[model samples]
Target: MDRRIFIKNTSLATAALALPKIDPLRSANLAKNNLPKWKGFNLLDFFSPNPKPVSKPTTEDHFRWMRDWGFDFVRIPIAYPYYLSIDRTKNITSEDVYKINPEAVDRIDSLVSMAHKYNMHVSLNLHRAPGYCVNAGFNEPYNLWKDNEAQKAFNFHWAMWAKRYKNVSSKKISFDLLNEPSMREDMNDQLSKRSAVPGEIYRKVAKAAAEAIRKENPRHLVIADGNNVGSTVIPEIIDLNIAQSCRGYNPGIISHYKAPWANKDPDHLPEPKWPGQVGNQYLSRAMLEEYYKPWIELTKKGVGVHCGECGAWNKTPHDVFIAWFSDVLSILSANNIGFALWNFVGDFGVIDSGRADVAYEDWQGHKLDRKLLNLLMKQ
Candidate 1:
């Protein structure tokens, strides 16, 4: 059956109050059935500093590349405010958010439809939500947790998506709700107590957003990212019956040695190498597992777990990234979890990760890293 027709006829979008509940047997079945082994890539261009209008043909080309490369889905990380105005000056009012940005809505529709055409899933993520972001020196004007206005904006954006794409198949479309919510001392430096904690605010805002989305369409497999850039701590919203997502970039010295946006002090960090000595200890799969143990425990608790984003920045050596990636992918697969690589075309992508040493294959006006591609395909 054609996937589009299948999605339409199945009425997969409408929902009852069936948010994920903790039933080990049921969750295990869901893991086998609903949760696909999503070998995916994040379409991150829309989240760039100066967001560009996405062309349909560009998205189609990307879908084709991903399908041809054995990937099954695309994780789209879009900044919502980019849709609010061309100049990005709109202070979205409660009444104004409901006034959907037609251009943005159409673009998302096109992206999702194209993914369905390729028989691929779409995990739509708000990398920059109304109230928070992991990027340095950037933040929304209002506090999402503390301010009713910001929470309304957050809920409004997601609810609009749920209602808009309510009929899309859960298999084909899911939500990654927010990007990495972290405790950054740099952002809003002297904020109030409640507003200061990232996890606490994330938890409240996520609950509200989840409730809003589910109200629109119940079965959306909403995914909430971990605190501190998808690291060790899972949010307290597990009881909300939503999926948990984590970042796989472990041993900062190796995975994020000198990542531009990372908050770590580069001067104090050791040089990175996979299975090489960082200090007295070697960075290996075992260490990665130790960091991942908490997230794995979440899966054991009957909520779906996915590594929503993971990849080495462009500066990391190609050989080292491949090795680290292999370990990360293997461990996630072994545990029956789905993961999406950070991107497909830019800094952290499989095709355009910008490794200085290798020759790149030009495809559809973009360069492809074939060696990395081969490594990814072999997995």
Candidate 2:
């Protein structure tokens, strides 16, 4: 199906504006439980700056906690480089890339099993694909969109995962094809125009990967993130029968205030306040609705919309963080969109996100933010 046609047909309908129900496919992994609105967190150990060994017991405990906390799913962002063999040279082919990373594969396999044990679904995302990653200064030797080998390697990686997880039900697991693909090297540039080039390239790559996975396991669900850090601007790839993912960090100043890594803030920017002024613009729920209009249109077309990543950075004041998160989650819930906060145990997590400014209590032997946790549970 042509993207133009999808946009034309989908834009005509209004958003469903309700949470997703459980899987209608009786045999699917999530058929019995539904999606639980997929309110969950991301497990980022593999992609963090300091990678740690995968501990089975620890992993199981995390899954257990997610289930106990009323969360439904977890997104595992795997850094592909961790699995690459140092002996291999740069710019390898798909076949070479596939055969080199057994350790990473084994680690993910164990985690996947743990998720199933606790009845928690998992989405495996290639945070660092063969040729592109959103991490700054960590440029791939080849351009993912222009390099033939990179494209082949990326598709092959998904195919490999499909074959490996062939028995896993689609409802239990999904493939978030790639992290955040953008047209320009710098991701934060002219987001609207940047969306066009990467949007088209991503469609081709995503469809190829989806086709490969479906060949091995037809029932597996595939998800693709939007350009510009999965912001609004959903590309017309829903025709591939895959779910669409976006980030929930709208009003960037509030979400990423003083966050250096994202570089979203400006010099001498005033303190970000929820529903307050950010320079000349007034940021509020109305703005959120306008930003999410594209995703709403997609959902009306029967496409599952998800916030694959969203949260306030630790640098933001705790009260402000809660306020911003509350508004974002409300917007998501009102529109029936599911989301996974940026992290599970890190700086943007429910448990021990290093926010000393907020009061915390011990729950299940973990330093838990009772207020934040309770708020999320209610949502």
Candidate 3:
């Protein structure tokens, strides 16, 4: 079935899921337990995946907490660089990992197994992907499509993953082809124009990965995110066929508000909002409508879309953060799409990296308010 046409014909509900927690656009069939019956989610790597565990990430502990939080799924961002080698600009020579580092491989397996133990849906994404990602700092010297070697290598990696996870069913796991693919090099120069380039590349890599996945796994949902990494940037790709994920944070605005690149960074202008405010840093319901309208349209057209990752800066007030999350989660719930917070805990992690309850509000564990969890758990 042609993805374009197939998407064109499906009712919007089957396509993208949203929250805002009103009457769901789609029917909310209660499970045997009669819960809200939404597709649940959690943002993975609450703290950065420390190559050195006990010292960095509290691996097993976080997973246990996720399960305890009642989240139904988890999305893990995995980068291949740990296994592959590129030159100074970090340009991937073959797109394939030259070494497939043992540590990286072990962590990947461990995360997957951890999710399985809890019966949570696991989404594997290629973050800071070899060829391209939003992190220009990490991109070194790579460009999508322009590098044939990278493209081929990317294809090979997907093929490898498809085969590797062939046995991992969607019931327990899924795969996001790549994190955020900038269509062109000058995304910040002129987002309006740069957005379109990624569509073709995404289709190429995503379809290749999907085909590879379907050939083996058969049921794992293959999701693809829109350009700008967020639904707001490119309205055109919103209705695209692949499953969708978006990076909703405003660069240096909220989560990255203070990031050094926000100013000099060409990708985005720094206009961060302060926390504990309603209209500024937090995304409101109307804001969600504007930001996610494209995703809604795509779902209307028949693609499985979801708000994969959305959260504010850890420095923000917990109450303010909760309000923002409340609003965003409500919007996602209304639509039935999955939502994962930026992290469960850590530097950029949900917990103070891995100290568990040791830190201040920064620690993911201490910061987790049961009230918030209960509210989110409500169908």
Candidate 4:
């Protein structure tokens, strides 16, 4: 189970299978724009909407291991509230949003620097923006899409980050404007009915934010998450010259499975099976291909695309997760699109994933899912 032994065993097993090496030039030709198919993981050190501790800090070992294992990118999905000094007991006012805490900023700066130190491209994303979040938990003073105050604050925060990393090269860093843009009936209700942000409104907000960022550094790369919680492509923003981000968790039934946050009644959901029946619906790779058609077409239009987050929770059977995820990665990789797993060391990662069926190997005191790691390395 040691790291070296695991690698040795995996290498021999892979050789026995006689898998072909990925052709670099062929992969490069699949991409339409300058975007490289960056493959890596999302580090959740600052992902919680609440300021309190939710996840641990990412260490240098993560970067080193990822680089050693053949990954070149890391997406840091941050919740704005994590870095701002605000009274969590009350709704955050526009003024309260600007109370920037130097310590939190320093911690974030360190993360960006550490990722760069290992030659990893960092894509900074606002998972929870000033006025909006897909999940329900915190109270917002104003609506991002309907209120002027929230829009202003959203632009302000992006502008601040733009200025903060203005000196960094676009090749090494990019900004994912927001995490999953959607309109929910109630911002504080987790189960609130949700829909995509109106195309015009989404375009307006993205345009303004892109302008703010460009003002600081015109060469800085910018990306927008797909409308409707990262599922549907935003045709409205294609002309904005900004890239778009898509999700990997299509057909929530598979990706989410028994995740409480994803389903209202996780207990009642049918057991998941790849390319097989689950509940009344039959799921298959053909369905996945249909789902990603829009995203793949977006690439043909010369718009850069990336799967910012993808991975199933630990509850799903390990074999099913691998089967479904392999199809997801294959579809994306074939089109020259890249992906980042939801995390690197938690419930949806290669290390310490906590899946019941996985035969975990030990690596630097962490339980490494060698099978999952091998699957990821192949693409």
List RMSD in Å for every model shown. 11.4, 11.2, 11.1, 9.1
| lDDT per residue as tens, model 4, 308-365 | 9999999989899999999999989888899999999899999888888999999999
Candidate 3 residue lDDT tens string, 105-215: 766777678778877777777775556655443433355556666666666666677777777666676777777666655522422334545446555656666776676
lDDT of 2 by residue, 77-144 (tens): 98776666543335444454555558766877887788888987889999888777777434355667
By lDDT, who's the top model here?
4
- Give candidate 3 regions above 4 Å deviation: 1-55, 85-92, 137-141, 184-198, 232-241, 250-252, 261-284, 347-350, 353-375
Give the range where candidate 4 is weakest over 10 consecutive residues by summed lDDT: 25-34
| Candidate 4: count of backbone clashes, pairs at least 3 residues apart or interchain | 0
- TM-score of the candidate numbered 3? 0.71
Candidate 1, 1-379: lDDT as tens digits: 9999888766654433355457785445333313556778777656753446553224677788788888897888877765664434544444543455688668767777788899888888887777666663344566555678878888888998888878777888888888876655444442322222455666787889999988978987798877666775555776887887878788666667676455345556666788888777888888887877776677767777888888788877778887888888777776777778877877777665667966888876777888777766765
What root-mean-square deviation over C-alphas does model 4 reach?
9.1
Candidate 1: where are CA atoms >4 Å away? 1-34, 54-58, 86-99, 136-139, 186-201, 233-235, 263-269, 279-281, 359-366
For each candidate in turn, the TM-score is: 0.81, 0.83, 0.71, 0.91
The global Cα lDDT (0 to 1) of model 1 is 0.72
Going through the candidates in order, what is the number of backbone clashes in each? 1, 3, 43, 0
Comparison by TM-score, 3 against 4, better one: 4
Query: Cα lDDT for residue 249, model 2?
Result: 83
